[model samples]
Target: MMLSGVVSAFEKVLIPVAGRISSNRYLLAMRDSFSTILPFMIVGSFFGIIEWVVIDPTGTVMGPNGMGLGMKMTGLTGEAYLASAFVATLKSLQALCNLVVTIGFGVLSLFLVAAFSYRLGGIWGGDKFSTALTGIGAFLIVTPQQVNKVGGFSLDYFGNKGVLAALLVATVSSWVFVKLTKNKKIRIHMPDTVPPAVAQSFAVLVPVLFTLGGFALFAALLTWFDIPPLNDLIYKVIQAPLMGFSQGMGFSLLYQFIIWLFWWFGIHGHNVTAAIQNTVYMPAQLANQDGTASYIFSNGFFEAGLMHIMGLVIAVFLFSKKESWRAVAKLGAPAMLFNIQEPLAFGLPIVLNPILLVPYILAPLANTFVGWLAVSSGLVPIFRFVVPWTMPLFFCGTIGTGSIMGGLLQVVWLAMDVFIYAPFVIAANRIDDEINEE
Candidate 1:
């Protein structure tokens, strides 16, 4: 009874709060901005896997301590394979893959600025394409230029390190552009006889100029005071500290707990946390890929490591006596293999089920801790690739961490989760049996 009352009180507070967060326009724009670049990131990751696994001379398949797939396939000794023209051809292929990766995810902040500004501008009733262009202009205005080389722009601020600055610039510049465009006094008037494209272009011109100019002025002022570029300043002052805090085990546990807590109340916890995930964990994952940092906990860790639901599904089938439980398990089994938990989460009715809540929450928390420990202790490789959240277990781990040990680790985590859920499944069956007898 106490548990029930406590749950009710928490639900009254949490649901409304979570709903507002999930619906907030700025957060929504940020979330969608990340979503917009996900395809490109995935494509980059796919090519990156190929580069590391199949082509790169210094990578898993061909490196000094690698599996020697190249040596074996070429019918040559390890030293001979390294010297052969075939290795040169492989290097060329690797270069091509790197080229794609360099453009796709290496300059993600640029895409983030455009996507965020486009989405937010549309919401604020501005010309989206022009506003997006203006956002990019603002970003470039504040980004440091190369002083030693003519017509040269440094790409230092085009990557994940510049993400916070990108979003901030996008928000402020997009709002300014929209507000100016909406004002009759600011935007130039064009006759209806003009082609729609021409008229629209003219209408956004003044707003775009002002938006970009304001950022240019800000950058000039920073330079006059000998301050670092805005991107570097924001990263050092705000993003770096937040990222460090997010890397702590305590934060990881709280993050995992809140996800399950929201799930327990039938809220889409992942959606509620989407903005935070994009802003914090996504950059960490990119940093890991770029070799700039070694963060063990990241978006990839959640997707490829802790998102398993198959253990609970297996437990239900093995221990549940209730027909409804078995039926949901059978229906959810296929989806659970791909890490889609909704069928089991809602269909098995894990939501609000006191008996199942312990295991449902505990399973993921255990996985998060174990995964973190494994990576931090060097028992498993840190995740580097952006494996799709729906990618099947074992495979995601293997590809994401670039090691077979990663797949083996998932097997271990799966067994642990099954053990955690089994007793609870049996207890729920017993309760149902008693209820039926009554």
Candidate 2:
């Protein structure tokens, strides 16, 4: 539904504008599609940064001494500080804001590091150029201890600007490479009739090659400079994005795999919720609370927990045309409770449904806003307590946010979810009924 609206709006608004610039229908269409995708990429990149840089720095971006600043900031307060309502309120809000900012920063940082590394690799042609590999490396190496040390040494020569020096070197090197290669275009020849497997392989290989080339170029640049070892820079650049992408993809795949596993055993896949909670969710909770580890797990549960479950399931249930209501029932029970529901998703047959894809992406984003509000308003506690993900929804809220009021806010979230999804459900059910009659 959300996606439909976006598409509709884009056709009405963007298409006309694009048509004026390009007389060719194909070019106009491509331009419009690109324009539509740009916003999502930007927004995704922003949230990704938050998750990596701010929320889960320990796990995502931080080095050994990264928490020093946070510790120093919090150390200024004592137990007595918690006693003051004003201070408590401020601290709570600060923590929440910090988490959001960190996650956003982390995601953006990943993109920056990747983009820079790609450019760097292209300049030097140093090693196997793989963007994914180099990006993973950069993420690992940019930790606080390493960054501070590099920055500190650089500062000794360049004043407080040594860190800036590194950033500058990275930026300039990347810009030059992009300028050289940006205009080059390649065309692949595929038979008009191709086997499915061959087509799929080709599809996968294109991106893989691009990534490798990007990484190799970054490696080459490092070797040329002899400033930072190509291997070290590449390693750090690659780690965070690689981990984040893999973790997210792995959890998603695991959820679906568990659903199938349960169905084969004639048991509902709902129990997989507990597994997710124990594994990914619980670790996220622990990391958020760990004194030196807080940044790494910031809002981990919210993104990995509440949003993931709700976003995909809700989108499918609302837009599907098969067993819509039944699917909703299957999903809503565990979703409302444990927040897991892949069985419901498969039943809905929503995987490729165009109309439903919109909300699948947007609804979780809407939930993010709600979570942010709860934190900012002090209605929910900022992340403080480390609890299991399978903990009841209310408890998860209370402990994750660190306030009783936060627990109470979960009720509001429940209400919001129902409200947002109900219309879509009704629409889906009507569609399903019509299809059945046909």
Best by TM-score: 1
TM-score of each model, paired residue for residue: 0.70, 0.36
Candidate 1 displacement at residue 377 in angstroms: 8.3
What is the per-residue lDDT of model 1 for residues 95-158, given as tens digits with 9 covering 90 to 100? 9998887777678788889999999998888889998999999988888988885766777678
Query: Which candidate tops lDDT?
Result: 1
Q: Which lDDT values do the candidates have, in the order given?
A: 0.78, 0.43
lDDT of 2 by residue, 1-438 (tens): 453454455446644544454454322322232233234343443443444333442321221223433334444334433344544544555466555444333233343344445545544442213432444443333332225533521112121112222333344434333333333343243586998667544433444455445655665676577746532343345444444532353444444455433332223233223324333444555665664443322334353235343534444455544555455655565643544343444445333333343444444545556665655565555566654334456666665565666667665665566556655555555644556789
State residue 90's C-alpha deviation in candidate 1, in Å.
1.0
Clash pairs (backbone) in predicted model 1:
none
Off by over 4 Å in 2: 1-297, 304-341, 386-392, 435-438
